[model samples]
Target: MNKYNDYAKKMNCLYAELPEYLTWHKDSKEWEPRKKQEVIGRIFNCHPSDGEKFYLKLLLMHIRKPTSFKDLRTIKGKYFDTFREAAQYLGLMETDSTAEMCIEEAATYLMPAALRQLFATILVYCSPKNPKQLWLKFENFLSQDFEHKKTLNQYAIKHKVLDIIAYHLDSMGKKLQDFFFVDDDIVTRTHDNLFKEIQTERDIIIPTEDLLAIKQLNEEQKVAYDQILHHVNNNIPNAFFIDGPGGTGKTFLYRALLATIYSAGHIALATATSGVAASLLPGGRTSHSRFKIPIGENNSKPCSISKQSALAQLIKSTKLIIWDEATMAKRDIIEKFDEMLRDIMSSNIIFGGKIIVFGGDFRQTLHVILKGTKDDIIDSSIVMSPLWQHLHKLKLKQNMRASLDPHFSSYLLKIGDGIEYTNDKDEIQIPPQANVPFIDDNTTLNTLIDMVFPNINDENLDFSLFVNRAILTTRNDFVHEINDVLINRFPGEETTYFSCDENTYTCTIPDQEELFHSLTPQGLPPHKLTLKLNAPIILLRNINPNEGLCNGTRLLCKGFTPNIIYAEISVGVHAKKTVFTPRITLEAPHDNFSSIPFKRKQFPIRLCYAMTINKAQDQTLDFLGVYLKKLVFSHGQLYVALSRARSIEQLKVLIRPSTPLIQSTDYTKNVVYQEILKATDTH
Candidate 1:
């Protein structure tokens, strides 16, 4: 116990298992190969967005002291013309075996059902080279539990496991007949083309505290809960909006309602505008995923739901529909949802005569309008809809945090309502106590990082510190810089992984590889990713919404198994839940960076020591460092940034260095569209 209690991983007399990545190096006395200097591994980005330069950058990052381009592409005696050719010859381009590695790593932590679902997702989205081989390799782990049920009949168990996999594949719009490993019965079953509804039944995994808290809902929550339940119990069609600010217990009320309704055996369809919020609810899902809302800028299309589809059946059976963060959605999207529901349910009444509950803080950022004016943005909000007038508006003014931090709560309200005193530039002064002592811009960033994560290397530091504290800025580039500074300071050896990119479209002439690597598409991971153990990272894409892995979701890295990175969900109800992430293919936005489309295959995660201000919504933190190096550029950005912390003590602001000409470091611009607040006012 004494020998194993300290840093010693292996007991002197006992045989303890270690991961394959770790091994005893006789020369280096460390679990991992020793580095010349213990510095964070750096990534190499090409000077220009060119294909050859990008490949050269990859080689430069891995190999030290490359004299020139020719040196990087030259092996022992073979001089390769293409950098990618040299990389492949060096055994860096191929990761065909990652499929098996992903399953093996996930098998150690994920539940059998979750692991199977992950495998299915990998097969569907990841495009592993050999899907059948992955199944064969992890067949025992995938159906480990069910295998015991029919141990005497191994063939039948394998068939049953394949059937379950077939069901999962079916839900994702794929068929089992394509996989040659399936049994004849499974192949015959694919003719039905069954549209299986994901999460057919609510699992009722609500927290005990939330369940018990139902009896303790403040008067505001009780009123909203009872009014909605009245219509649900009577099967009466009604539209209602639950308007509340950040800590007003909107999620608390939703969970309570879901538990009560699910317990009564009625289907309550729970969804949210964002995946993070949706994952907090029992059986919650993104409205876009659940309703199949098309993503585009042109004339919106109705959700792709046929009347006879399983999704239509789910809509028909649904007794109540709860949509969280509804205000973040555009009015057109919501109207489209209502129209889809009406047609599917065969009713003209609002939402196809189903009970609909909408909840969000209108004070938070509205639906983003790309290159839009203030009027354009406000008009896009749900409040601007004519249907908004008909729905009964319910209010919840009792902010749960107000009881604990009165001043901060009131400050948030003042900022949210645009009542704070403004200067000539229409900016509000940040509280002095909340400001990080500023020196220079660079010094401020370092101080901001230190302030947010004090004593980060301490062994006794609370794990929640990583979850609760973050440096938030308005822009992604600023986020990248802050995260880079923090990850390097974090105590652990780092590993760097490079992406395998390909042109998005088939070109007659040729595709530029350099351009593909250079395009840092919004919401996609870069060509080079550097990660360290226990470092926090944010998911840039939604893997499985039900599992709480979604775009803007935060996780702490637990293992880095080459292809699969093991991480635990760090926020929301799914906090502490273990999940495995794989390098999924991500495509550039249509006409975003360039007309020539390209795809980047890499792990869908970025260091989250700092994240953009928009992603900071719905998160309550004990410590928050606001990097105003880039002042927030959107409505409600300033308010949302300041309001994340519970109190002024936990809040710190690091403004971009004050210019000698105009000393406005104490004040920063706050963009709040107060007109939107009128529609969301107390009913």
Candidate 2:
């Protein structure tokens, strides 16, 4: 270790202690070739937004002197012209055409290919204290190489030679007893020559293979997608919102659109609200991360793209941008991106001349704050805020999961009511249905464990738990309570408690936490995380808090503040000679009864078992049971529950109404009836 440390210290002295131009500034001091970068702070003083003059000046310094005007003209006309043409051919044009055209013949002849060496020399001389000695050393060094003439092409081809030469020179051990050092002014003059040669190539060409793949589209998809494509082909800016529920081939359609545009020789970009959502679309990244927009600090400033940055060019050239999970994106974030696009395109207008297709459900909005006046849905929560209403909205009402149960899907969504279910062929097991057990008894608990345990035994269970109410208390003391129960009884049960009352709100146990950490520790990843859970215990919102109802709901568990609790229920069982009861009511204990506000509805208490109605919310439970208690349908609750299930056969209802569960509500019936009518009218 000592020997290794000695060697490292020696190397650091050799390279780090070199009296090169890089040592001029502190940031340049750490330039270790491969790992460190020479700090080239954005030269804000230059005009034309491109460093053409800066690059040209650096190039001129390398040649030092010219023998004749014709020689200078040959160097300028042949070399400079060739390089400039190449840059132009590659679409490296920046915002400054006049500045780029300032390349004169005399200057070109005087500069030659000395940009790299000049950079190195200037970097070394930037250090005020060591400037003079470095200058004398550089002068002596240059005298030896003055007779040699290096062309731009040769310098480019032998870039490593300069690096190696500098490395070797810096490696030489000092043997002098005393030597007179040069002055800082001389050091500055000598430093000017350091960047004479182009040490490293600046830009590289990336193959468009990965980008091309995103543009492949099927004929069917292209037919449905051509409207936007045609607009882009005509160089018109357009925005589109493709809203559909969880499934309906939104992602597939996006891919087809991308492929069609790219195949037509157009560039395409993709973004999303969060990283997890972004992953749903091809070439995914969160909007903020993709655009590199600084949040909070400078909300007004948009991310800009310089032509010098290759990635900026790539984004600028892209003809289409597909943003998935659009609902989760805030108007400010979109606005910031729009600002960046306009800046890059050099236009005062919006959207950077690119066609953007947004895909997301407005109902699934993750943004807690409202952004603009457009596309604003005036829910009480966002009534006071400015709303950026989205234009060009397209509704995808067709439910692919409807194949699981078309009528029940419609009914569940309409009334916020859930249906009863028996078993899931997907898991080869039965899951608990609805918040209230079919019979409102302890027998439901037994039935649930019996049906669910066998399927759980067949495979390694890994899934997310979604519960509405606590079986025990109203306060969030359930983290340890729930953890202890599962650990003590089930032993190896993996669980995550989504406690709204708790400060952290939600934390997954082991697997889900690991997955979340891997994907999105900052917040929601760019893509939605979909994983299977086993023995997933959920606390349902069955009891009233005033009546000691624990505030538990799927939204709460999934991380939402419960704004209101509509009703309360109380049910329980006392087993003989046991500290713990075999069954507990999903209802809140009637202790804090005075806190709840007045309401017209009557609440019933039950075991708070997973009810069949929650199937509409897209969860698959694995315990079969029936609700024997008389069920009163809330305006929207029942519909949300029933629609969560994959299929209707999974539910088993004992006391369900003779007609559909939601036969009464005007809104429920309207949506269900309207969609059917639309289908009929289309047919």
Candidate number with greatest lDDT: 1
In model 2, the runs with Cα more than 4 Å from the true position are 1-224, 261-266, 294-308, 369-390, 412-644, 650-683
lDDT of 1: 0.77
Model 2 weakest 10-residue run by lDDT: 573-582
**Candidate with the greatest TM-score versus the true structure:** 1
**On a 0 to 1 TM-score scale, where does candidate 1 land against the true structure?**
0.84
Q: How many angstroms is residue 216 displaced in model 1 relative to the true structure, after the best TM-score fit?
A: 1.0
Can you give the lDDT of residue 230 in candidate 1?
89
